[model samples]
Target chain A: MTSSTSSSPPSSSSSHSPSPSFPPKSHTPATTAAGFIKAIESGSKHLLIKRFTLRYPEQKLKFVGDGYQFDPKRAVGIAGLRGRHILYHDKCTGCQLCAITCEGIAEAIGMVRVDEQWKHNKKAIMPQIDYGKCVFCGLCVDACPFYALFMTNDYELASFTKEHLIYTPAQLAIKPKYSGDVEIKIDDHGASHHG
Target chain B: MADLEDRISESQKMGMQIVKESDDDRLMTLSVGPQHPGSGHFRFIVKLDGDYIVHCDPDPGYVHRGEEKMTEYRNFIQNIPHLERPVIHDSTNITYSYSLAVEELTGIEVPRRGQFIRAIASELNRQVYTLYWLAIYGIFLGHSTMFMWPTGDRELFIDLLEALTGARVTHAFNIPGGVRNDVPDGFKDRCLRQITYYEKRLKEYEDIFYNNPLVRQRTEGVGILTKEDAIRLGVTGSVLRASGVPYDIRKAEPYDVYNEIDFKVQYMKTADSFARAYVPFLDMRESCHILRQLLDKMPEAGEVRAKLQANPRGPPGEAYRRVESGRGALGYYIISDGTPKPYRVKISVGSFRNMLALPHLLVGAKMGDMPVIYWALNYWPVEADR
Candidate 1:
């Protein structure tokens, strides 16, 4: 497919063809006028045509698939790939697997073992996730051997106040009620034990 | 003949005096630098004769972050994201090429779903990139509406992309084996809706800008680059097509889902600035067509990511891959020494290569035509200099 071919006319063809004497005269005035008219006609036709421009924002364009929604009870509640970080306070076991796996130098997560008073147990160590440094990389969730930590699809975590971003063990343990027949218990140990 | 001889004599006399002047006056050399708005990130020293640009020399090395050199240090897996930054707008294309290079080296096969997603992302990026070009071209042509319309419309596509991938601009969607993220729930429906909206809006784009008489007058026959000239200058993409050369990287070298897609390569024989502008408008329509086809034909269930579980760890090898970007054939040449980073990464950016044809295109053109010519070339300094 790759070849070098000489397209130089062999020099003989050049001699055979008659060379123009005056650099080939410019287009005639009649031909120029005709071209202009043709251009104008085509242009006029385009302008006269109907346009389909939607005035957005003022007229809110309804996106398709607003209806026929998936029920949260029937759908698997597993947070998909881009899910935000969540901490399982009870099952944490104080393992720093998530902290070790974070790629960036500026760690967004911190695993501080704070002593907690429980009715059944004398002392319990809980982990806290600092949202300030966390990129929601989901590394910590994967590293937790006890499966105490899991990510949630609820990503509306925006806050004007910086202090509100830092999630404590109590804030991280809040679980929503099941919309359907599925009954799930949110244990104080930060683990979801499904019966 | 007398008038021509008189003008020649005057030019010669002017040239002789300049040549005879002192070293400083011999050539009033001025630098149109590595940080100028009009010149991209490239520096240019132009020797001027009065107001006329006599001779111009381009100096390019400002945003050269030693990408090629950096590649030698990073592993194959890590280089994928690094390579994507050069032409960040065309994320899929860059990452896809890097993937191809890695595949070629390791002989790994990407699954069908992976191929489809790559194509989808690349085409979407192409559409948005074309809008960016159109907006810039609009401003260059003295039509403010064209500029504003495309920029505003671009946000819609960005929103759609954000819905699919977490990030909008730098998706980092494509990795070694396949895309990082699969099409999220309701993604296809959203994409179809956007496509529908784009189809309707394309007509408005034509009426407001392409069909406008002023735009046509300013562009038609302005920079006529013949097919022969295009080939000689090594032009690719829409620039080559504008000159009647039907050479598209997608068609010439069938990569990814491009071979499967039923789309025509847009072309025009005019080879002028108008033709350049026209090619992208036609391309947007083709992109819309391809998007529709992709949605209908995509597999219902399949593996999205590649099975290559291990991240690139060590050693370096060279990989050169090319893809049809919005501007033209974007080529990436990477040299890795089997390390964590690339030893040398050289990006043959589309805009930079296309810009090479500018000085030639702009020579006989008037000063008023500079902006039009600049926009028509569609040069991105960040992509070019990177």
Candidate 2:
């Protein structure tokens, strides 16, 4: 916020400044020859230049020492954050708080109800996330009334076709299959049934 | 002459009068943002006389998305990933802070494996952010080579991140108690290769950009912030470190696996833009050092998530948590009211706090020097706006 200025007295013309064009009266040939030799020895021209950069893809980098080390299974520390998607299908109580919080940027998630199957049974409605539109904002996960929907760190939703991106009930099941690998189940217990 | 007379007559008819004022008497009000490339998303108005800045006022809230108001409608577990977009470059740190707040409220102890992964992800993010800063700094100095090298080098790390998380920017990898997934097969080899590549490339960066005489000339003594001034303005992270404060959130408050790691918080005594730029360079080296240590110490195989006491209901209290972000300290304040959703969620972004000191640092500097100064600050617009 504060400004300070310093000014030095102006110098005379360049011609009046020390001119190297004139020979020094006390210059010695032997001293000049020694100075030239020193300059040549210290110059970068004689030093070996490095070509250390890699030609990537064709020539990949190799790390020294031990190989790849992955984290231990079920190893949580003082501060650990992971992805968890919960389905509170029964406690949902038909409130779309999640949709409201999604900010509507991607329209990636919604709630739907399936028709009743039996005589007296009520229709079943549940929240579904369309991975295609889900920016993974987690707002929809947070907006659930029953804590039924959550985000999982199982983010390998890539596919050859865009159609595969649309996640359904079976696709988003507690033990969903992702990228040909079995999804890591948090526990052996089945999905929680909340009423 | 006729056009000037007509303009004056039109102004008089429109009730706009010109008052003659002395140069020393009248204050020149200059507006410095909203749309200005130099200022991020916010604006500043400064009153000045000659080149000396007098009073400065910053105007914000333009990019505010009402996230706090919006959080009231979202559920507990769902909000974790929702909060990362504001500071996506430091995604792990942002999500980790929120997770810590929720864990504190719910009394959930995180697993060790998850802590290590969070540390690795955060350090990778730090490296990427520093690379981006270096690129921008190069652009500011009109050195295209410096700009291109780091960005190209950053792609190597990004590819490594993509391999680990399956996503680039919005990994949303951290949950309340642990990380979402464990590292995949071959991830260790990929990360190690990237580390080696970066180590070699860093020397080239030092030769081409860090030690470049032109860059040093432009940044060496520009926008100097003293230790007293930085502390008074509440500057944190590298900016504070540049002033010889030696206070880093990672050190002051060791969260995650930082306590277990062997790394040093880099500092410089200059406190100028050059020092600020230099700190990130050293930080990149520190990140590489930490990455090597992490690779060495990381467990072979284990579950990444912690076991929570069967799905518990939302807590009735609130908790606030802070962590070191790429820019500085990012904090998240969350309030739960016994419901599945949070009542209020507030995030204090590092870029916003860092950019607040811009007017103080920018004034009196020539207009041509603005871009270099802005680049050296390394403020992300989305984070600042959010």
Candidate 3:
């Protein structure tokens, strides 16, 4: 029944090429030679152009802003890369909204009791995120109504041990210095990575 | 259904008896996937009588994370990241369907600009996903350059996506109310430039991959799914269209500015492996045109996201919405009970539906034609097993 409705063709574009039982000439020596020539010609042309690949670790792509930030009034996220979570201890109320939100999702953030006593944070707790299970979806950043949490440009969270992969509140507090300006630039030659 | 079940069971019994009898014969069983690099997180058993396959059994569920069950635990907003997990590459459309369904349940009106932006994201994701599929399909059929070009060219769209959504692969951009955020400044000019460049690069794809006689010989007339068979089997996406049905959800259903946009529903009457492959290429060309139109027609400024309560809830009801994803007709059916969490979420995916045609086509195909026939079906394994 559903198929019957969807079976009819909508308006056709000029570029639309409807096949009409046209047999493919695969074995013809002429077509085969031409196909090979054209395929090779298109491929080798890229050899003259610079490679699109970035030598990672040695070169990092520059980001636009400090990181993903949320405005309580706007009720929307500012456009930025989703990398690692950053926590501002001064702003955190220890409301556990971030922990509540992360429960069903990544469960990456764990509320750990902190040593310092702050006026804003009555619970004396902060979110310690485990990068191991975290998808970096950045929902934890969105849940922070107090503007205490946001994702930084630091994506390199790899470690030798599983225990070390978990970033403590103190570890998450430090801002990452990631810099290198690389963007995909297109020109007459072709699209290539430029820094 | 009963007759089909009986026939399958009968065949299985006969096959089991034949296996006992043909212990001395030249029948060989080759298991592809679940661990193989050639197959994505999927497994299929093919009984090869010499070079030709006598029987085929596709075993999915390798990467099944119980997504529907998981959705029950998470609320509507929290479910976005979880739902996009299945088809991570084509995350926009996967979540688009969910957001549509959720919006219906919650009654959040997406702004005009937001709808256009959502549509643009879906089309770009379609390109990203199709290029990825084409890349793997190329390598599967021994065309290494075909693999390299599309994979490289895919970055153009991925770059555009990263700028728009702030992530490369698993965007998780689409939310219940609208997209996560608006497109950044100077995005139009950059998008136009990259899209035009990508369009130019597509012609080269034709020269190397589609028009190549080597690929043609291997693909053409192999696993010919007739129009009647395609319809009877209930296949969707390019696979169904390649069998001469111009059934595009964008055209037929007309969700999110697709009704206004002018684009062709790419279909071919030949119903061969070549037709299946060619249809997506044509679709890509049309997507370029649609992207241009969408960018030109979009509003200058508007509220991209709807203002909603912290824990948004709607009255008890169910809503179902479908979108034309790269794989096929991806849909979400959500039932809400005036709560933050969804009571039930059913994902009706294209890859799973396309899997129905696998055994039907693979039973009689030659071993050499396996990859071509299989990949040409547009079956993304993770999505199917989700």
The candidate that wins on lDDT is 3
Interface RMSD of 2: 18.5
lDDT of 1 by residue, B1-386 (tens): 99966876897676422233445564466676567565656766666655555565555567776566655655565455556666677776767777776666555677888788778888898887889878878776667767776886786786566555544566656766676556767778868877876787687676556655556667877878887777777676788777765556676577877777766667777788888878888889888999999888889977766555344433446777788888887776766565545566677777777767776776655556666766787676667766
Candidate 3 lDDT over B253-301, as tens digits, reads 7787887887777788889899988888888888999999999999998
Q: Which runs in model 3 stand beyond 4 Å of their true positions?
A: A6-28, B1-26
Q: Which residue pairs collide in model 3, if any?
A: none
Fnat (0 to 1) per candidate: 0.01, 0.02, 0.54
| Number of the top-ranking candidate, with DockQ as the measure | 3
- How big a share of the true inter-chain contacts is recovered in candidate 2? 0.02
Q: Predict model 1's lDDT versus the native.
A: 0.62
Chain A TM-score (model 3): 0.85
If the candidates were sorted by their lDDT against the true structure, best first, what order would they fall in?
A: 3, 2, 1
Task: Identify the superior model by DockQ, candidate 1 or candidate 3.
Answer: 3
TM-score of chain A, predicted model 1, versus the true chain A, to 2 decimals: 0.44
Residue B120 CA error for candidate 2 (Å)? 0.7
TM-scores for all candidates? 0.70, 0.68, 0.93
Tens-digit lDDT string for candidate 2 (B1-386): 99987987898687444334544566677777778655667676766766766655666766777666766765555565556777666677778888888888888777777678878887888887788778877876888877776786676565566545545677766878777666766666767766776776676676556555556567777888887777677766677667665555665567877777766667777788878888778778878988888877887866677665433345699898888777877888988887767778888877766676777787777655666666677677777766
Predicted model with the maximum TM-score: 3
TM-score of chain A of each: 0.44, 0.43, 0.85
lDDT of 3 at B167: 87
